[model samples]
Structure formats: structure tokens, C-alpha cells
Target: MLDFRHISAARRLVPVLLIALALAGTTAHAASGPGASSKGLRLAAMLGSQDAAKRAKGLSALRAWGQESLPGLLAAMEAPSAEVRRGAVMGAALQPAPALAMESLLNALGDPDATVRSLAAHTLARLGPLAATDVARLLASPTHDIRVAAALCLSRMGPDAVPALAAMMRRDDPPVQANAAWLLGGMGSDALPAAPALIHALDTDDTRLIHVIAEALDLIGPDAATVLREMTLISARGNRPFSRMGAAAAPTLVKLLSRPGTPMGQMALFTLARMGDQAKPALQDALATGTEGQRAAAALLLTGIDPNMAHTLPEDLRRTLGGAIHLN
Candidate 1:
């Protein structure tokens, strides 16, 4: 019988030689003449190559082998060395159907090594909406690297992942909540549905989560207005979070420039005043497009920001704040 140590060594040499020599290599000769077991060995060895060129050659060879390379790649994932396991992960990515390899990749996402887990996540992310739930679950993993990998993957899934991420925010699990906020922010405008959740997230005592939510709001920008028209219905205990968002919360506040005495208007005035120059663009937009009262309010609010905007306001629209309302 062939020596076990030699078989392991042969598996390495076989694939490399197969790249240059093809039929001349011992493993290639073995692969060509016989049962799929021999060919599988050839495949695993090639894919497990330490060299990128050889691994790429292995991937090309895998594409040519079509579905035939799968069993061997699956078995290779169980190998003791991380290198071989990574090779198997890459090889599985070649399969046309995600279903064929998803189970294995999911298992791989839990691999002790972060690199292997990340590779699995990237592969899953390529499936678009199909892999969203699986990746979202990883946000709860004890491993920070895995959580980051999962967040980045879900961000790439577009709006398909917004619900899963928004649901994560409701759990009060700080790490998961934080990662979800970061992912939603990365999704930008597509994550608008989660804006209210992100807005309410400021109730957290966790400073890290608070900062993350703020940053996400900044990235989501004007879309924070999704909650604007309904702002009267939300609790008014604090406007700190809205003000914390810098310019991003401006659009929502601009809506309130017309209604002076209302709770929402008071909150908007205080928050917009605090934003200074950051609130300039939205106020300028309002000046250009708002109703007469809105343009008047925007001009009055802008007086604190731009001395000339007050000059641009018609004498009637330039009137001061109403006595009935007080800035919060």
C-alpha cells in the first residue's frame, strides 16, 4: 500500500505539476486513467496550492471539471490545514448554484480562522438577496471579525437586507444593534425604512452604539425625512439625537419651519439652529421651493447662518419668530 505520509506529499506535488505538465504528472496520470476518487485527489491538491497562480489554475481547472469537482472540494474543506480549507471554500465558489455549496459555506462561516469565515461570507454575499438572512445571523457571532464580515456582506445585498438589519436594532443587543446601524448607513438611501429605528436608537446608554447610530444617520442624510411628516406623532422628550446628526437631519427639520408653535416645529428650530452651516443646503432648498411660510421660516432660520439670506427674504417673509413658539 502507498505510504500515508507520501500520499499527503503527493497531493501537494500532484496539482502543481498538473498545472505545468498535465498528463506527465504522476497524479494527473492517476487522475486520467481511473475512478473519480483519484481525480478528486488531483483537484484538492491543485486548489490547496499556496501560490496564487497555481490556485487560479486550479480554479480554472475546476470550472472545466464542472460539477465533478464538488465532492472532492467538500471533502477538502474538512482537512486539518486552513490552507486546504480555504482552497475548498474558493473551489466551492465556482459552482453555478449557491444551493450546492451554501450548506458547506455556512459551516465554513464558523471556522475558527477569521480568513476562512470571511471567504465564506464573501461567497454567500455574491448570491445577493438569497444570502441575506444567513449573513444577518452572523452579526450575533461571538467573533468580532465574523460580525464585521457579515455586516459588509449584508450591506452589499441592497434593500433586501434592510428588514433583517432593522429587526436587529429592536433586539437591544448592543453589538448586533451597532453592527446593524453601521450596515444600514453603508446602504445609504436604500435603507430609508430603517431611519425611524435608527432615530429611536438614541435611547441607548451605550456611547459606542450612540456614536454609531449618529454616523449612520449622517450617511443616510436627507432620507431621515421619511420620519419628518409624521414627526408630530413621535415622542418629543429630546431633540439631541436629531441635532447630533449634523446636516443629515436638516430635511426633516426644514418641514417644520412653517409651523411655529407645534412641538415638532420647536424641536426643528432648536436642532437646525445648532447645526449652523451644516443645515445650510436644506434651508437653501427650502428657500427655493417651500411655501411662502416655509420660505419665510427658512429665511429667518438662515439669518443666524447667512446674513445675506435675510436680505434676500421679502420684507413680510423676514418677520421674526412668533411669540407663541419658543426654540427648544
Candidate 2:
């Protein structure tokens, strides 16, 4: 079984996935002249070809045709060949008007092939803010598969999708509620405005919901810091305490660290480690003769705070504090 305690703390230190706009738009030949029809037809046909070279050639031709191929590409999304369908979607992705291109991608979202659906989701996400309305529609779709795809796409849309996400939070479904919390955190500061909803979610007894909301609050930073601090205090006395609370609240909980001889200060240092370099100076000062637990927490914080600073800390300090301590 996963150690729920340490997992929450590590989650804050973990890096957010790299947002790769793979289909955002890539280079393609600009089509022209009477041969454009021939090129487009050839590309459409290549979408189903067994030969990889021919398929590549087909993609090249359709991309060359640009916006002119939108209608044909839309029609080709239903092609028996999954490759053709995916190729058609990719071709549309390269067009200046992806809104039109995405119609086929949206339909392709229901493709029996999981690979095709994942590709469509990734492509729509790459379209960024333009995919917002489509993603919102996906969230409301009858199929959970579509909803998941939409949620994933919106998560990648960053801050732009927060308004729509905040609206979705009103729904009582736990999956929707949980995903909304995750996406809000994935967006960072743009999600600052979502503090109230997350704070309310944190009050729920559901560990899943509370942990996710706590993570989101960290992403929202100090704007949501005080609530997390209060919750930490509440949790400290509750049946289920939140050891990771201070680490998540590190950036905004600086004042807690400034006061000497406080438990909150130790928590702040742990949180600072999660925030890395941003929490450095405070962590350095807090390291002074605290306890084995405090020093160990500082060592963990230093590992990721800043690569340069990590080198500055003496090896003896790291070795002395190498063992882990229970956060509570």
C-alpha cells in the first residue's frame, strides 16, 4: 500500500509535467496552383496506405493544401483506416483555423481506437485556449471517456480554462469535483482566483478530495495560505492529520517561519523544500539547531531548493539528516 502520509509531501516536491504543444502547429509546404487538388487527393489516400512512406507523403500533401482541405479532412475522419482518421486530424491541426479542424478531432474522440482518442486529446490540448469551448462540451458529454479527455485537455489549457472549471465545480459528482481540483492546481497562479472553492473542498472528510484541494491551495499560494494553516491546525487535532499541509503552504507561510520557537516554522521549512529555491533563505536560517527532525526536513528541502544551494550545504549535514522522519 502507498504511504499516504509521505506521498502527500512528495507530491508538492514533484515537478509538474512538461506541457508539450506537439500539434500546436508545425512546418508544412504552402499549397498553390492547379495541382493542389491532386496533392490533396493523394494525401487523403495516403492516410490509409500500408506503406509508411506513402502515409508520410499523404500527410505532406494535405498539410500543403492548408485550409482548402478542411472539408475533405472533416469527411475523412470517418475513414475506415484509423491512420487516415488520425492523419486527417493532424492535417487539420496544421491549418490556421483549428476550430474547424477540431470538429473532426472531437468526433474522432469517440474513435474505437484508444490511440486515436489519446492523440485527439493531445492535439486539442495543444490548440490551447482555442479548445476551451470544445473541452467544456466534452466535460458535459454523456461518455466518461469523453469527459476524461476533456478534463485532461482543460488541465493543459492552464489558467484560461479556470472560469469554465470553476463553473463545473458546482456539480456534485466526485470525479468532476476531483478533476477540477487537479486542473486548478495544474494551472498555478492563474488559479489564485479559485481559492474559495478549493478551501471549501478542503473541509470535506474525503481524504482524496482534501488532499487534492490542499495541493491546489499550494498552487494558489498565499492567497489560499491562511486557510491551509487553519486547516493544518484543525487537522493536528483531528482523527486524520495533514502532515503535508505546511509543505504545501510554504511559499505563503513565511510569517509562520519568522516567529521563533514555533512548530509552524518547521512545517514552513518542509514546505519551502517543496517550493525549492523560492524558500531558500528562510530554510537556511531555520536549519540552525532545530532537532533531528527539523534538520532532516531541511536536508530534504535543500535537495531541490536550488541546485547551486544544494552544493553549498555541507555533505556531513546531508548525511547526518539522511533518514526520514514521520511528518506528524
Candidate 3:
């Protein structure tokens, strides 16, 4: 039984497999190489098979060839059958050499099948920094999926892409700086190398760029602790950065909580309690290994936010907090 109402909504969801490139001409070796053509034809048949086992068997053989699989994959990419083309896109990912993939998948960008195009982009992303510069160029693409894929691809490149982003940050342009910041944050802790650059970008006059940089710093969590530690709990300028920080700011807040009678301590408690679920892991870590003051502060904070979690505190910490308080 199918629900007719949900069918349109489901059909609109693009099966995002992701790939890219222009039809940069190179002779597809499998089309002419001895023995490769025969093997490639068999591979295309198995890869496009309706049976899962045959597909698995075909995929294993493709991976085993590593870079040697490139020619067959490229030849298969040109097949008249869209299913075989889609399978070729999947096969490209298994080898994932930029030298091979960039050429092998060039045809897939114009692939009429959306799934094949998406799968191609996804495979290209697996090429990491080798494909990052080209993909980063697409961040400003008018196409929504293209921009998303570019960002996703950059984020997955880890530390290797930081220097390129660090260079982008130096440009006088605001959008480029902001996008670089967003991508650095996307790299999380691997972004440590760019911290100095990020800190320097705070000199910009644009409020929007400033806000995005701050949010990006927040996304990098404690990696930006040098920045977070200095955030004034009262100022709008300072508080906004800290506010977007979620649990990453918990340790410093817990430190403020150590002096529970102070205004900073009260505000820290409120901020931690307001963070809800995001604060749990940090709070749990504090309870487990932090100083007595941190443990006590965490227990009191958790009691107001999550009584069940408060009750899970160690016997020593619970005794120190004089037992958890009732929310009511």
C-alpha cells in the first residue's frame, strides 16, 4: 500500500551520490587497451547487475585493482546504459586517485542522470585536497546542491586544506573570508593551524563577517579556547561569541562556577543550565575527573537542568552537593 500524498515529496529528494568536471578529452584507455576492454565489459555487466552479490563481487574486484581500475572505470563511464554509468561513478570512488579520477569522471558532470552526477561529486570528494581548490570555486555556485557539495567536500579534507583556506582568509574580500572561516570551523580541531589567522580576521569592519567568524570559532570548540576564555560574560559583543559556543565553553564556565558567590559564577551557572543537552558530556567529564569545585559546580548545575543526570553523579559528588534538588 503506497500513500499517494507522500509520493511527490519522496520523488523530489535527489538521491545524492555527488561528482563533477567538464568533458576534458583524453583517450579512455579501456576503450583501446588490450585485455582491458574485455575485463571492463564484464565489470560493467556485473556492476549494473540487479543482484546484490554480483554487484559486491564486482565492487571488490574494482577496489583490488586500485589505480589500475581507472581505465575500465573511465570506459564504463561512457556506456550508453545509465545504470552502468552510475556503477562506473561508484567504481571511481574505490580507486580515488585525483590524477585518475579527475579524467575518468570528467564526463559525469554532464550526465543526464542526477544520481550519476551526484555520485560523481561524492567520489571526487574522496580525492580530498586534490579536488578542494576546484570544489571551493563552486561554493558561490548558484546551484544549491553544488554549493552544499563543495562545502561538504572541503570540510572532509581535514588539515591538508587549512593552508589554502588560510590564504583565502588574507584576501580583502568579505565573502571569501567568511566562507573560509566556515570551512575552517567545519574542519573542527584540525583547524588549529588557522587559529592565528582567524584571530587576525577579527580586525574586519563588516559586522556580518565578524559574526560568522565568531560562530565559526564557536564551532571549532575548545580549539578556540584562547578566544572563548576572554569573552566578557556581560557585553553583547563578547557574549554573542560565547553564546554560540555551546558546551565547548563549559570548562571555563565551570571555573567561574568555582566562585559561586560571584556575579560571574551565577551567570556561568545560568549559561550552563541553558545549554541543555550540549552541556551533558562536558558536565559528565567534569564530574568524573575535575577538581572538587568543578564536580560540585557541575552537580548543582545538572540538578536544575537534568535531575536524572544529576542523580547519576558519583556517590562522593552527590554527597558533596548534599543530594540532587527536585525541579518542582
lDDT of 2 by residue, 157-224 (tens): 66777776776665665556677777787777888766666654544435465556656656667333
TM-scores for all candidates? 0.57, 0.53, 0.48
lDDT (tens digit, per residue) of candidate 3 on 1-328:
0112322332233232211111111223232235765566666665556666666566666655556766776788888888888777766665656447675553464567666665665556567677666666665555545554445446556676777677677777787688788888777778877765765565555656765665565566543245444442222254374445555556555555555654445556777887777777777778877667767888877776777665576877766666445422
Q: Supply candidate 2's per-residue lDDT for 321.
A: 47
The predicted structure with the larger lDDT, 1 or 3, is 1
Q: By TM-score, highest first, what's the ranking?
A: 1, 2, 3
lDDT of 1: 0.65
**How well does candidate 1 score on lDDT at residue 41?**
53
Clashing pairs in 1: none
Error of 1 at 13 (Å): 26
Model 3 regions more than 4 Å off: 1-45, 48-50, 60-69, 78-82, 96-99, 103-118, 202-205, 221-328
Q: Which residue segments of model 2 deviate by more than 4 Å?
A: 1-42, 45-52, 140-144, 201-207, 224-328
Give the number of the best model, judged by TM-score: 1
Pick the lDDT winner. Answer: 1
| 2 against 3, candidate with superior lDDT | 3
For TM-score, candidate 2 versus 3, the one ahead is: 2
